[model samples]
Structure formats: structure tokens, C-alpha cells
Target: MRFRKTGAPISFIIPSGNLGNGVAALWTKKMGLPIQQVHFAHNANHAVVDYLNSGDYEPSDTISTLANAMDVGAPSNVERLKALYPDFSLLKRDVAATSVNDASIQNAIRKSEKHWGQIICPHTATAATVREQIGESTNEWVLVSTAHPAKFETIVEPLIGKPVEVPAPLKAILLNPSQSQNISPNLLELLDALSGPKV
Candidate 1:
């Protein structure tokens, strides 16, 4: 709301596994913004696209894919999305949902690195696909980079044929002082851990 006065274009191209981001986008439109569109770029698991296209909106079993973040089949945010776009007709008009499978996601990631010199994560790759389809336009597009490609080295490195260097910050976090205790599968073990070390 604070940025409303700035008169910024509110077009968002977000990668969604579920409809949480989708709901937020719709909310912007409801709150009154010069929103050109709310484009949802989903991964192989594409319940969001199906819901937006048809009123089916049925949740299904999760299909694992490279874009693990978007691996949700039964999106928990459907109710919230429905609440924002009560009218199915209006929802379709404001939102553009498209699904990209494993093959496409691979291509996107490869193309991104080869052409754009960017090592984008799988989730961001989905958004890039839709952005290309939409083409260059006056509307500003905000591509949400949910995670760093370095995290998914197993998937990305083999495809891109290059090692994704772990970010220094991530390395530091991993190297930070850590503590853990082996315990039985019981609440007592958890409670004991929370109480601090044995003296």
C-alpha cells in the first residue's frame, strides 16, 4: 500500500508450486493497482494452472520434480486463492497460469546459463519461460528467485555441465558451530535437549 503512491507498475511473473504467491498477486489487483497481469509460472506439478484454466481446482498427489519447491500437487493456498478471486470468470481474466514439465525446465535452465549467463534455480527457470512467452513489453516483470542454483547442484550441474560454486554465505552457515544429540523417538528426548547440556 505504501508503494501505491509511487505509481509503479504491478505486473508480477512469479514461479508458484502452490497458489500462495498467486493469492498475493490477486490481492494486489483486488486492492486496486495498475496490474497488467499476474502470471503464474508453475513447474511439472501444475495444479495451479489446471485450476486457473478450468474450475476443476482438484488437489492431487505430489509429483516430485527438479523444482522441488514447486513439487506440491495439493496446494494448501487454494482456499485463499478462491477467497481472493471468488468469481472464476474474473480470476481467469486477471491471472495467466502456465505449467512447464521436467523437459521444459531443463531447457530453461540450460538456455538461461548458455544464453543469459545466469545459473538460475529450477523455480526461477519456470518464471523465465513465461517471461519469454510474454515477450519484451513496457510492463515491468518481477521474477522471484526463490532459491540459489548452488543448492540444487545435483540437478543443475549435470544439466549445465558446470559446477555451481556454493555461495560464501551458505558455506559459512554450514561451517557455523552446530550441536545435536541422539535421542529416542519421544517427547522426553526433545524436552531434555531443550533444557540444555547435561552437567
Candidate 2:
């Protein structure tokens, strides 16, 4: 859609954890879209950046960050990426990756609100931070906004110094009771939760 609108090859700086979104962009490029580069913007959890830069796939423990959605140490799609681009050099050429810490995420949020009057979520801020790092370029860069700012009020409100206004549709959804549940990563715990209360 952005390609059609811009009428030129565009590069995407996507905030990724599992690398699903980044892989999707790569597929788009494979399909012959006018995509120049598919850059990944990672938060504090930087397994992807480390792997891409070093050509060594070493996944460590997950590190929590303001960009909670992207707190993935072990990206599930990396194997797919490796399969798609077997050569490390080709993979590096096809994709660009970088990591931004919590401080940068906060700064991105504050700067966006202050300078552009755009209230972006922490996940989006990671991509925004990367875009700042990349600076101005002839190639059009699209920083993917993963979620609405209002969805992350706890993190974003304090940074931007104001409450993010929830969109009408999101507000309506929020008014409904949440059906989410918290459980450990253990399969037994998941099975128990799915099985419901004991008689």
C-alpha cells in the first residue's frame, strides 16, 4: 500500500521481536515490490541485531523493556530467515538491523510528541529511534507503527507528559471486560488453564 502511494522503492524500519513482521517485509520484497531495504528495529532485547551483525545465532534470556511487545530473546522466524537467505552475506544485504535501549525508546516518544505532535507507542518508538539513527536518506523510509499510543498509557503517558487519547474504536473495545489470562510458559500450566477449574 505504501509502495503504491509513494510510487518509489521504500525501506521499512519495523519494530520486531519474533521477526514475523520483518519476514513479511522480506516476502514482500521477494514478490517484486519496490522495497529497497527491510530494516529491523529491536528494543533492549537484541538477539536479532546481535545475530545479524555477527553472523552467529546466539539467543540469550529475554530482557524486558518499555517495548514489552518486542521483548523477545529468541526470535522464532530467524530459522525461516536463514532458510530463505542461506548465505550470511546475502542475508545481511537483504536486511538491516539495530537495537535501541529503554532510554532511546523514552527519548523517541518524548521527541515525537514534542517535535511532530505524534504520540507513538514504545514499540513504534523503537522503530522511530532507529529511523533517527539512520538519518535522512534519498530512499524513503517507513517506520512501522505497531500499536496505538493509548494502548501503552503506563509507559507512554509519563514520557510524553500527557494522556494519549484512545481512539473511539479502541475506547469501545476497552470498555468491554478483558478475557486475558496470565500463566507461566510451562505447557502443563497452559493445559491446566485451558482445562478450567477442577470439580
Give the alpha carbon lDDT tens digit for every residue of 1-199 in model 2.
8767868898899999999999998988889978889999999888888988788999989999999989999999999999888888888887999999999999999999999999999999999999988887887888899999888999999988888898999889989997878998999999999999899
RMSD vs true structure, all candidates: 3.0, 3.9
- Candidate 1 regions off by >4 Å? 1-8, 32-34, 136-138, 177-179, 182-199
Tell me model 2's lDDT, rounded to 2 decimals. 0.91
Cα shift from native, residue 55, model 2 (Å): 0.9
- Tens digits of per-residue lDDT, candidate 1, 21-81, equal 7678777777876686788888877787888777888787889888888899888888887
Task: Give me the candidate number with maximum TM-score.
Answer: 2
Error of 1 at 141 (Å): 1.9
Candidate 1: TM-score? Answer: 0.83
What local distance difference test score does each model get? 0.84, 0.91
